[model samples]
Target: MYETIKWPDEMKPSRSPIHFTNELDVAASVETIWSLLTDPKAWPSFYPGVQHVQLLDGHARFGAGTRFETNLAGQDVHASVQEFEPMTRIAWGGYPKAAEHSRAYHAWIITPTANGCHLWTEETMRGPHWIELAKQAPDIYWLTHEKLLKDIAEVAVAREKSGA
Candidate 1:
């Protein structure tokens, strides 16, 4: 029995002040979408803002408790999996090494649909300098996520067709 996980207070849009959410109706199974979402290394290939991902613990697929680091949107982020639900959701949060105390939480939720599934991704950024950073580059907050979701859908569809 899968249940929707409650959003942590820190990750809540109202609590964070700077938040963004993007959803995509993908023509792929929840498992397929989940696989792509869990693969950190593959992210840079499709997500423009991501430069690299290095796993500090666990394998290429991140599960609960897995720790990793990434260069996202020109920020060095050290993150660990805070929550994971197979084929349903995964969320992570950590501070950007580039910034003194800036922190970010990103989550993905997949819900089964008649044709396929609905993929929703949201992110929240908070800290003393977060607002200034958001003001400096607001596009990274939402636009990149939209592109990432689109890319994931295309990959999932292709993988399904090839029977991979």
Candidate 2:
């Protein structure tokens, strides 16, 4: 369990050109939320911007140093897991494979609540590519992340109802 998620020096909001954060309290078990998060295979069904996720390493679940590839932000991104604590926290740093200039770190925290769990997610991005994207839509990442949280919560509730 983590007391707090760690942010890389470069990916800190003060240093990055773009940053996004979203959170929601879900009346579902941490296991339920965590299962959805660690399963990249189920991402396309929920995460709007992600597609064709494939684990680079042989592991079936995300763990420290695990790598994965996905199509995100209109490009192919390769990501590596940096911090992972089961049922409590997970984070990754990624960059578009075709570009050498951009980088991002995404992190999630799960806090147990009286009803269930409180989920918080944040992302920090920097470099030329993100700056240009921000220019086009400064709130793009924020809006997208907001929807992602809603979607995940909805799905989690449904999954619990179905006893899946």
Candidate 3:
């Protein structure tokens, strides 16, 4: 069971920004998905285009108010937890460290289903150069997210087999 997260202004679909949402059903429990989602260290392992992640608070897992810095698509990103509800929803929003003048909010929702869980992630980016960035690589958004869910599902399935 789960509920949609109250998205921040930055993540709102109504806002003016390039927005995308992707989802997949996984044969893993909500707990399993949550474990992988909260662990910043696990992101680079499963998330596509993530080069590195540094948890600002020095915690292995992120909860409400946690901050982190990550390299995405070779660009530095500074972000903080925007919404965190254990086993259900998690989100963060921030800007690029460079002078791209872009900001975005990324959110994930995990809901239990008959087989396992449904994981959905959405992002909205807004800035002066947002259109140009999207134009540069239009396929990145869908392809990246599609890979992200598939990778997470594989990790979750492997974890189940390992009994970890």
lDDT of all predictions, in order shown?
0.81, 0.86, 0.83
Query: RMSDs, each prediction?
Result: 2.6, 1.9, 2.2
**Candidate 3 C-alpha lDDT tens digits along 1-164:** 12375767555777846878899999999999999999887887798878778888878889899999997655688999999989989999888887447888788999899989999998888876556767889877767888999999999989988999
Model 3's TM-score against the true structure: 0.92
For model 2, what is the error of residue 155's alpha carbon versus the real structure, in angstroms, after optimal superposition? 1.1
Candidate 2 displacement at residue 158 in angstroms: 0.8
Ten residues in sequence with the least summed lDDT for candidate 1: 1-10
Cα lDDT of model 1 by residue, 1-164, tens digit? 11354566766667887888899999999988887778886686577678778889758689888999887766788998888989888989888886758778888888999999998888888886667877887776788789888888998999899998
Winner on TM-score (2 vs 3): 2
lDDT of each residue in 1-164, candidate 2, tens digit only: 12376888888878887877799999888999999989988787678688788998898977889999988777799999999999999999999888757999989999899998999998989888878888998888888888888888888889999999
Where is model 2 more than 4 Å wrong at Cα? 1-3
Q: Which pairs of residues collide in model 2?
A: none
User: Local error of candidate 3 at 160, Å?
Assistant: 0.7
Candidates in descending lDDT order: 2, 3, 1
Deviation in angstroms for 95 in model 1? 1.4
TM-score of each candidate structure, all chains considered together: 0.89, 0.94, 0.92
Q: What total of clashing residue pairs does each candidate reach?
A: 0, 0, 0
Model 3 gets an lDDT of 0.83
